[model samples]
Target: MIILMGIRDDEQVQRLISLDSKSSLADVVTICRSYEAAKCATSAIRAPPDQLRAVSAYKKGKKNKGHEKNLSTKPSPTTATFCKCCAKQHEPIACPATQSICTSCGRQGHWARTVQCPANQAQCLFCGHVGHYDKCCKTKKKDGRQSGSSGNSSAPNNNKHQDTRINSCRHLGSAAPTATKTPQPLNVLVSYGEATFHLLMLPDTGADVTVIGKRHLEILGIPQSSLQPPACTTTLTADGSTMAPALGIFKATLNLGKRSCPARILVHEGVQTPLLSYGHYKAIWL
Candidate 1:
């Protein structure tokens, strides 16, 4: 039988001998020492092959090639022709110039549908007087002779007109108007013993506690407490992983506008910003 000996000073060798009573020369066929096994392992690791040489050559080839160029570039500026009447540069579809004459006022700049005759105080469009369009007419049905009474009767009321205007003004095709409460900015104040600090009110209802950074705490001359307990809870970040919480709470006074509230300031170990968490805001203000 083959025997392996791991010698480590006198104590280890004695311990190994005690494990087996058959350590005698008559029982052993071959004995392999630890030093011999280590030398064989070292020699195998140092030896290089064809695959390693090929990999080194490929890396050198990549280094010789330059970096790749970006595919994106800035867009060119757009130019447009100006309209003769409006004097504005736009496409033909967007030009406001009109050719139809106003029947009531005898004008050529606008269509008959929008002609308001200032001479007789008559709207040619609604009165069907021929020169102006129907939209610019200001005459009531009772005061003047109604030429297009039938068309006026079929027109929409004021409420429907307002609704049409609102719908046309909307940019998103199918979005419903949703009511949202606007977030108000916060007022911040820091106090340590005799020293005082004034800060903005940052109301964040999503956070677990009120927090101040290390820089602010050090500036206020606040000493580190030895009795503080280590944070046990973990927080999940936007990157989809959990990190150990390095947060702690300290006592402080926060002035919110005209009123002042006693707040428990939470200190995040590596944070640089002074933030009031949603939990603290809801507890104090809301």
Candidate 2:
């Protein structure tokens, strides 16, 4: 009973209990010795080929003192390792694998892990994926726009409202004539700490910074007092005309698909349409 209680394997315990009932202690000792011998034989047959080679080399090196140092310095052929410059192990001077090249900018001299990639900086604020922005995400595609419509405006049927509205800043570059057709608006989900709301914004590739209407503070459940002073007093309108000076600057986070990114929004009372600038757009979708 004492021996059976100590035995962990069910088969071994049951066999020993049955044998004890039929035989004596001498028979149990013989059976244990046979099981240990069979286990040793099985292990010897299943030994790794690299381990066998290493053992043979170690034995040969022991016969000669000079070969001992050479064998110790050289790594085994089948051993797995992580290289500093590449994915696979190679000579110190040159890497045999192409993983040394940067996957982001296509540059050499460092791996993507060592050096920061442009794609990493441009990761989607939504969805948290690389190589694409939140605007390009398929899962959050319908969240922004519906089919066959330019955009859903916050204020409907307001003819005075322009699709691309700006503030008092000067328009960048010379006023070149553009098409009369209005550009499509991008619906962005913005969050300010605990407050989350959707804003209809124009994807203005020509604009320098993102700007939003001051009225959005009401929807965000944040007072205008929480806003900071604007970095620049003046802002530009879509038609190159100047309106009112910026009210203030509000730092908030924008969530699209699955990712969220911090954004600096220039809040203005005169802004009817939120403008998503070129720099933020490049970092997101470009």
State every prediction's TM-score relative to the real structure. 0.31, 0.37
Candidate 2 has a TM-score of: 0.37
What would the per-residue lDDT of candidate 1 be over residues 108-138, giving only the tens digit for each residue? 5533333123323221222323222234444
Tens-digit lDDT string for candidate 2 (1-286)? 3343455667666767766465766788787778778878989889999989998999887878767777898876664455654555565556554444565445555565432344433333333334433444443454334321434445553332333222211221223223122346766788887778888777665577798777666766778888888765456564657757777888887765665568898877866778887666665444
Q: Which candidate is the best by lDDT?
A: 2
lDDT of 1 at 212: 67
Clashing pairs in 2: 125-259, 125-260, 126-258, 126-259, 127-258, 127-259, 168-235, 169-235
Query: What lDDT does the true structure give each of the candidates?
Result: 0.51, 0.61
Index of the highest-TM-score prediction: 2
Over 4 Å off in model 2, which ranges?
Answer: 1-183, 238-240
Model 1, stretches more than 4 Å misplaced? 1-185, 225-227, 237-244
